[model samples]
Target: MTDQPAVPTDDPTVLTDRDLEVLAEQLGREPRGVVGIAARCVCGRPLVVRTAPRLPDGTPFPTTYYLTHPGAVAAASRLEAQGVMREMTERLGEDEELAAAYRRAHEHYLARRAELGQVEEIDGISAGGMPTRVKCIHVLMGHALAAGSGVNPLGDEALALVRDQWRPDRCSC
Candidate 1:
């Protein structure tokens, strides 16, 4: 029996020095440690990353980082919103004709909803319903139209008709 402390099976909560170095390389900056990582998230508020620092018995475990700062979280939210808007604008374009078509289709949907007594309780309509199914077809058509290459409008209309036929009312009739 050798008189030596049992080799700790526990892992470190902080990133290994090598791991930190690699992270720094990927991030293109020097990360001093967890504090540095946390500081990066901090803009106007402290962006603390909560992590599982240890096991049940205080044995060190892998760190799991989470954003805890409101400002950092808000910034992330803004970035996501901007990305979505940019994508929508890029895909849909600012074309007057296309915009008018979408508006007309949307108005039709609204009218259909009102006729079905579904305007107040929007959840009343099922995905299998005529209006909802047609809405989906419109969405697909919009995507196809947005491609802006050699898209066949007749094919889009035909596909929309096929989709409309699959609706519960049409299927039953």
Candidate 2:
């Protein structure tokens, strides 16, 4: 990944100049390889960005839906600090149905990223420690926000856990 200037996009999630500016502000750097805004706050600020599978600098970016909202990022961090990932990871080992669902979620993530473009380096890999572990609530929450509820069970759970602190329905931007 190089620190190149963000590439402009014409995809369906194509961002306006204002949107790019806000994204840069939220990320504290230039938002790289962003194709579209996957999720937005109630007030219309970008909450999750749909990034290119391959970056402009020829880096394979496995994370397609990246959470950028400061409030949502902080909420996911708070959940992680509360030992939620350990509990979720433990439950994944004990629940067959949940495990299957998580695997499906992983597949869904891969499929979505495939639409952007095929990146051999990240092929078959999805972010958020999907299918086996609960590594980053930020990634899962980003997926949840981008794909909507029910597509990602763990992501949905993470979103639920942080509802009191942050929610898509509420303006936390």
Top-lDDT structure, candidate number: 2
Each candidate: RMSD: 23.5, 6.8
Alpha carbon deviation, residue 136, candidate 2 (Å): 0.9
Off by over 4 Å in 1: 1-91, 121-173
98-144: candidate 2 lDDT, tens digit per residue: 99999999999999899988988888889988879989999999888
Worst 10 residues of 2 by lDDT: 1-10
State the local distance difference test value for candidate 1. Answer: 0.31
Top TM-score prediction, candidate number: 2
Clashes of 2: 0
Residue 75 accuracy (lDDT) in model 2: 96
- Candidate 1: residue 95 lDDT (0-100): 54
